[model samples]
Target: MARNSADRLLRQFLLKAIGPIRRLGIPIPAKISKHLQFRGVVDVSVGSGASFKMQSHGHAIENRMYWYGKRGHEPETFLPWLEASKTAEVVLDIGANTGLYSLGAAATNRTSRVLAFEPVPRVAELTRHNARLNPSSNIEVFELAVSDENGTAILHDPGGDQPASASLRGDFLDCKQTEIKVRCVRIDDFLSEVNLSRVDLIKLDVEGIEELALRGMRTTLQTHMPTLFIEVLDARPELMAELNGLLNMGYQVGDLCSDGVIPYDLSDKKGVERNLLFAKDLSRFQ
Candidate 1:
């Protein structure tokens, strides 16, 4: 018990000292900065007229954005996302971690509608808070998970400090025993319920349940044929199934590059690329 208290005190001291260290311009190593956890919200600008609000709590995505803007977080994905957002009338940000993509998309096109889905309660609230921080942007925060079916699912969260890693699958990421039951919905049904007829682009990164969510939106995929920006960590069975599903629907796959997207051969089992673009028409990205 005494050891636990000592450790708690040490952590509190360290968290308090980070601010003064930053004020002194002391260089904090990436490894150390990653583990530094605290609670606070701040508005960040990525230059131009693009900007968003982010809450800091050791989340890699928000921290990177705070330090290096969208480029540092996921330039390959974010750059294309922002470009697509400029003209997209409707965007769905599945697994919207703290409104990074949602707010940015809304900022790029204030008239466009951005629907952000986050299952974790606290994380969803954080997204809402970030949206509120940007009053000019049109972003809707939904505290629900998108899946193949409409029901409730156990969302596994590693911890409060690792909100970005939360997922529907219990085994996904380094999920701890901590879990929460969150409402789930099929994309098709949800959109129909909301009376949204068009979806210009979709940013899907739902940890390991990507396939299930895709399955739920099969109708939308066929009808809307929206441009898709997805994180493909590797060729898992679930991911491959959905990739094949899209490919069979006449969607071409490409790897997001600094210049633009290039055709990607799915046969390469090595899984070198972490992100991919699936679209019926690749010219939109060019």
Candidate 2:
């Protein structure tokens, strides 16, 4: 696997170069990342005995290849969840997009239920396809966006880099592009409909509209208070509401990096590094 995906200088360089652009609200990186081919359907090992099937032209494939070439991706977030997944009842992936975190959870523990939500029709299909590749894993792919409302909304497609980076929030992508209407639902409402009693872990990465999505999941957040791996793009006042809300729900938040999940401050955003892990009991995370 490493021989096929390792040291593709151009591909890795492109992904690295576009990192800043992506953080600046540009979608060009996502577009290029999707079309640039490093290899075809290479396997990615995410550590802790977990692996995933990734693609050459898929969204974030270059990054996945880098992990294959080096070590696993986001050990600060991935490793801890993997340790806990064996006993977790349910793992929710909001914006799964080809099953990065979702596939990792399922691969780590076949008994745990990994529910992946990707609103883009094609991306959702791709996620399901990835899940199928891991026959022993237990994962369910849903083709709907989770927001603060139950209805339909315009999902702006990046049109090249990948469908995984598509967004429901307007002006998400700096450049002009096309869009498709997608069904949206709040997690709280869907949980009730499905009668899910508990959710052990959640990975939320929906561009920058995460605050709105959390608003709709207030009940679920209060009930489960599941450990959350969320990415916040900006430190804007609006986005802070979401983090503050979690605090009000008796949860603590921190940045998830290679070292660990450390105390996170909104003013300390370094770049596109926005993944924050929230927990009611920090000791569980430690």
lDDT of 2 by residue, 1-286 (tens): 6764654666668656765664464445334555454445656665665676755453354454533321335566666666656667799999887776787788777778889999888778778877887788888999888899999999988876355568887788787767899999999999888888888888888987888888888888898888888877777677786788888888877777777767765555462446787887666666
- TM of each candidate vs. truth: 0.82, 0.79
- Badly placed stretches (over 4 Å) of model 2 are 1-38, 46-50, 55-63, 66-72, 265-273
Judged by whole-model lDDT over C-alpha atoms, candidate 1 comes out at 0.81
**Worst lDDT 10-window in candidate 1:** 37-46
What lDDT does the true structure give each of the candidates? 0.81, 0.74
Poorest lDDT segment (10 consecutive residues) of candidate 2: 64-73
Q: What is the per-residue lDDT of model 1 for residues 1-286, given as tens digits with 9 covering 90 to 100?
A: 9998886687668767776776465666767666654546756555476777777765677666544556656787788788888889999999997778898788888799999999888778888888888888889999999999999889888876446778787777753567789899999999999999999999998988888999999999999889898877678877787888899989989888776788888877865447889887777777
Model 2 CA lDDT for position 119: 87
Flag clash pairs in model 1.
Answer: none
Q: Number of clashing pairs, model 1? A: 0
